[model samples]
Target: MKHLTVVDHPLVQHKLSHMRDVQTPSHQFRQLLRETSHLLAYEITRNLKSGTREIDTPMQQMEAPVLTGRRPALVSILRAGNGLLDGVLDLVPMARVGFVGLYRDEETLKPVQYYFKVPEQLDQRQVIVVDPMLATGHSAIATISLLKEAGAKDLRFLCLVAAPDGVAAMQDAHPDVPIVTAALDKGLNENGYIYPGLGDAGDRIFGTD
Candidate 1:
């Protein structure tokens, strides 16, 4: 109950509602995911490092506050996380992208990394990790560790819906990092799925099943 951070922006709330509806088409669902990311990105990057520069407008020359350095990197958690990349990218089109593929190990109940590719010199840049469902948190927890090894010191975790258990795991393991989510559902089920969850994100988004 305490670990979740719900994003209550009207646009985010509206899109999240559509995202939960089963009738949403794959195309629309993907579109909504990207749009929601824009809203969520607003909250996560509210404190993005920026600098003021003197620039000339059509009318006159004045100091303007612009984003510092390049756009924040979008670090997708692979599979389902990709669904969120488009939404966030719509807001930060120039942001560099990265991917990490992790699957669960049944016996260990931990994330097993299959692949991870981050932008070069990520240590100097802020990173936003995107995954639609935060179910068990094993993947997010392990992914954060892996990201740190790759020199990602400044990181933010973003999810569409997070279970209480997953949020706790994330908060407990990575208290330094902030989590931004649209909805914080009740809890996880016996199969380690968030109750009333949107089901398998990758499958739902990609229509594989």
Candidate 2:
């Protein structure tokens, strides 16, 4: 079974387990999202670009590596994605943040874009698009397509939980952008929600209907 990666870090796994429980409240759920986002941020940015420069340390000059180029732009895919934004920013405080708002229509079952914005000169910056769950994947693909149209060349997608169908959809749609997800669960249920998913991410995070 090609299951999505459930991150091995003890803290990440523990928080995720808590997030999966139905009894978790909105406040704590949001807090968990922030914490997990930071943990995942560590894994995703491990190979980020940096440069070495001479630094003086009391005695003599020493080589030190500092981040190179621009701080990557972090784009959150609307309401649910915002939950991840807090955590990611904690890890990369210098990263510029942007947002794309797209919601799936219950009746049509298609993504609808109500808002979209990205930092200028996205082409020169690496962009990390974030969301808690990769369910149907329409929103992620469409958001990426929009970013591509806006001249974003470098891209990565981050999610906490993903379903097999969504991963396949994203893989087929974007072979260039590698996905970084913590867990790949069984599959999507009939309504296109991930099976055993921590319920609706947006709803859970926002305490909405």
lDDT, candidates in the order shown: 0.86, 0.87
Stretches of candidate 2 off by over 4 Å are: 1-6
lDDT of 2 by residue, 87-139 (tens): 89988999989999998998766789999888999998999999999998898
In candidate 1, what are the lDDT values of residues 122-185, reduced to their tens digit? Answer: 8888998999989999999988888888888898999999988888888898888889899998
| CA error at residue 5 for candidate 2, angstroms | 5.4
Clash tally, candidates in order: 1, 1
> By lDDT, who's the top model here?
2
Q: Can you list the residue pairs that collide in candidate 2?
A: 5-182
Compared with the true structure, model 2 gives a TM-score of: 0.95
> Alpha carbon lDDT of residue 25, candidate 2?
96
